[model samples]
Target: MKDQHINRRDFLNIVGITAATTTAALYGCAPKDQKSSGSKASSPVPTDQMTYRSFPSLGEDKVSLLGYGCMRWPTIPSPDGKGDLIDQDAVNELVDYAIAHGVNYFDTSPVYVQGWSEKATGIALSRHPRESYYLATKLSNFSNYTRENSLAMYRRSFSELQTDYLDYYLLHSIGGGEGMKTFNDRYVDNGMMDFLMKEREAGRIRRLGWSFHGSSDVFDEVLALHDKYHWDFVQIQMNYVDWRHATGRNVNGEYLYQELEKRNIPAIIMEPLLGGRLSNVPQHIMMRLKERRPEDSVASWAFRFAGSPELVLTALSGMTYMEHLQDNIRTYSPLVPLTDEDKEFLEETAQLMIKYPTIPCNDCKYCMPCPYAIDIPAVLLHYNKCVNEGNVPKSRTDENYREARRAFLVGYDRSVPKLRQADHCVGCDQCNEHCPQSIDIPKELQRIDQFVEQLKQETL
Candidate 1:
């Protein structure tokens, strides 16, 4: 059910894609669609190019404002070409460069990268002195939810990550599945939630928090208990477009942030780019940014908006590529904090963006390597890109329908091969179970295939 604030037409913005996967993820592993079949070495450079933030509560005061999210590691095709594996060497180089440039916090979980993100993160960061950086991992027990398994997962993160003491520990995607019911089952009923609080008291877990993923009611219920648990930090999805325009069961970032501020809990931001949609915007909208600062990237504005807030502890970006790392590092080195005027201009741009019906998929490639050979990201990306280009066909009677029809169909064919297109999906729904975004994979494929068939049957 939608939140009370969400009306009939209040499109739940980009974050709406999350509902379906959370239930599938409760078992802790979701099958994601693989994107491509190539990976290469990452080059690491030594330089201090990041800004720092103070999290006095965490005891390490000089936390780099930019935190590395290890969910999207670089991958190379396996020997069989049927699968992809994490490029550990590339992961190391990226970690080295990030630490060399002043980034200190590294966040990972058990389920990221099919359960290898922590191991890869450990191997890379372990070479450096343990004290040189802070490690954050989670008790990510979505599937096989049991206190026994939860305890085992906690111990395993330390074993795999090569650390005895975790700098920051999270409860992992709470409010997933059936919202409050799932939250109670995973934490409250299992007695693991209280166990975690005691672990923090022991100093083994330095910081205790939870990452938000479901409804606003769940967010409120958790935060309401702040007096008893005293959450050190909470992670939430915050970006320019999501501040006031959030759709679905989730509330706006502005509201979430303010609630945190009122309770004096510091914030950790994820999806600051809204799954990369903010970075790859419409051309007319891109011009608005270029007019103001030609040198800065389109993504930096979103980062600045995320960073400008006073209570934010650090903004996390899953930088899998070397260039992604470099650009983000430079942006934060001396983050030009957003001003009131800057925010006003961004809100105006956001309002204009609502006209285009683009899918919120961040191209994270989490939903890649479709079992049916469907090129999932490519198909969705082409549709979104065309929407930005103003070629989305609404009706056959329209004057631009013929041209729009051609543009979409031709681009769809070129973007994704015929055999791997949406038509190939078997409606098995195995992919949806593993998606972090909760997008109904087979359903979306069915709809896209229908659209393609319609375009073929009509005439201008």
Candidate 2:
């Protein structure tokens, strides 16, 4: 809740507002070969060029540094054209390309993409030799943690994934919501953790760990369980910005990585782009990065930072488009680890990014299927996009006020359907618990709704 608002006067003083310079182009929805202005021209991505990492605990598993995150698979209009559906054919192509290029790890969860991710990922990866790639999924017993339900969910992952053995498994999105109390209810109280430990012992699950997004207290409490449970690996959100300036309840990457390194636990990275925020930075920040390394994509910087650490097993990217996949491949296909001076430069850039009043929504869609049908990620992402573009009008008297107002309203309507807009949020706070970022969903939606109202009522 760090002042998610910016007056025109304050913004004008913060950085030279420039409409001429735009942030990076959003991919996935674009054509296959589309290149973002912030990225360099496409170069050949070699099949044998990917960097690999491993530890004694992982045995002979040589994991690729570039892991494919199955959260944002490409989608096509459903046959009925009413809603979207995962394009299985497109997924197959992406998977084939990734494995050919040496990406050996695929991560998904039962809740991603409205619960279609595992099935689609399973379908795509099943076509390849099971040994060609490692499959990872989560228990994801968020709302229903009963012994029966949790067990059913765990078994269903195998059915959905079409795999007899899981290479890596996680306690899906632990340490959020009510913190350790919630964790206890989901894993400890229901005896799910013990069941998973037995599953590991039985060889059904080769490696077991948890992905964390909670307070430092919860992190410490869970990490302390290492002696008993002996976590095989841990997934954490790490990037240049979050290395030090993590918003919300997230612990800094510096601390998270250090804790894992001390225990010799390999760290799997998520949100290397901070939910795409690092790739799509503010215009001024983008300029500084481009000046430093004009050939690299804005995203490559974040990937390099995440992969630079020796403790990281792999860094995951949900590449829905071929271009994004290619760009990321070019980056890690033999990663040029950042120099100490480069790290210093990125830290300075991170400080500049923190000044902007953008919402830290990573568009994870965990808070989706809103009870009221409000498009939560759409609402928040649209607002953040406008903030980066300097199109959020704060006052009628300000210069470019008319343009900004029109842009915000028009873009809001286009980005979010009228029925799904922020004004419809009744503040039930249901989404509050699901968000891994610990966002106060109702409060943010209400604040945005009020702003929209003021804009609508303005006469001038």
Candidate 1 global CA lDDT score: 0.75
Q: Could you give candidate 2's per-residue lDDT for residues 1-460 as a string of tens digits?
A: 1222333334223322111111122331223455755435456887888999999998898999999999877665444434466666777789889988889999999888778888778877877788889899999989987999999999999998889999999998878768899999999999988998999999999999999998989999999999999999999999998999888899999999999999999999999988777877788988898899998887888999999999999999988877788888888889999999999999998998898898888778788778787878878887887887788898778899999999999988877778878999988988988899989999999999999999989987
Number of backbone collisions per candidate, in order? Answer: 16, 0
Which RMSD does model 1 reach against the true structure? 10.5
- RMSD to the true structure for each prediction, in A, is 10.5, 10.1
lDDT of 2: 0.84
Report, for every candidate in turn, its global Cα lDDT versus the true structure.
0.75, 0.84
Off by over 4 Å in 1: 1-46, 363-378, 395-420, 428-438, 455-460
Per-residue lDDT tens digits for candidate 1, residues 1-460, read 1121222122212111111111111000112232111121123333665777776676755788889998777665554444456667677788888988888999999877667778778877888888888889987787777999999999999988888899889988776688788888888899998899889889899888998866788899989978888899999989888899975445689989999999889999998987667766777887788788876767778889999998998999987666667767767877889988999999998898777777666554556446676767666767776787767888767788878889889977766667778889889887765455667778878988898898888855
For model 1, where is the 10-residue window of minimal lDDT?
19-28
